[model samples]
Target: MKIALTTSGENLEAPLDRRFGRAARFLLYDLKNRTFELIDNAQNLNAAQGAGIQAAETIVRAGADAVVSGHCGPKAFRVLQAAGVAIYNCEAATIAEALELLKDGKLQPAAAADVEGHW
Candidate 1:
């Protein structure tokens, strides 16, 4: 599965960014292949509006099967849902720990957006 994790750096050890839309970066990790790619989200960091929507589009374009973040907003949640991508909430300190939770089947899919837009 391709899991997109909100992060502040390029590697798995990077701290997880709590805000999905404004996250500094996204780590696209392939669970089966055990490989990863880093996506720059600097463009959306300062977006006056529609950051969530744009971020969601970026994830979709990156072919993420799921997203693991501290929180997801309504707009992003809807876009992801429409694309058949699952959203998971993880408060793990690092991206690596979040990956572990996913591998251990401890992370659960989010049923709805957890925070308001611009959060």
Candidate 2:
């Protein structure tokens, strides 16, 4: 499966970004192939500006089946949930570390959005 992780740096050991859409870099990792692909998130740099919905759409366009991030906002959370792409919350930064959680079955599936404006 293709997974997206918000990272603080280009390094695999870099901490996972708590903010989803506004993360510095978006790392696209393939579980079956055991490979890593880097995506630049220069366009979406402000998580609090309410860019989560657009960010989620971008991830989906980037071929990600799942998104693992430290935190996300209501807008993006709702978009992802509606799109059927699984979300894992509060995971460590970097695709490598996040993969560890997925392997150990430590990552939890995200629940429905707690927002009122979702449609």
Among these predictions, the greatest TM-score belongs to 1
Judged by whole-model lDDT over C-alpha atoms, candidate 1 comes out at: 0.94
lDDT of 1 by residue, 4-62 (tens): 99998889899989989999989999999999999989999889999999999999999
lDDT of each: 0.94, 0.77
Off by over 4 Å in 2: 46-48, 91-94, 113-119
Question: TM-score of predicted model 1?
Answer: 0.98
RMSD of each: 0.6, 3.4
Q: What TM value does model 2 have?
A: 0.84
lDDT of 2 by residue, 1-119 (tens): 99888886875677888777777778888889988888888677744465677788888889899988877667787788777888888546456778798878898887855333222
The TM-scores of all predictions, comma-separated, are: 0.98, 0.84
* Least accurate 10 contiguous residues by lDDT in model 1: 110-119
- Name the runs in model 1 displaced over 4 angstroms: none
Q: Which 10-residue span in candidate 2 carries the lowest summed lDDT?
A: 110-119
Shift of residue 84 alpha carbon in model 1, Å: 0.6
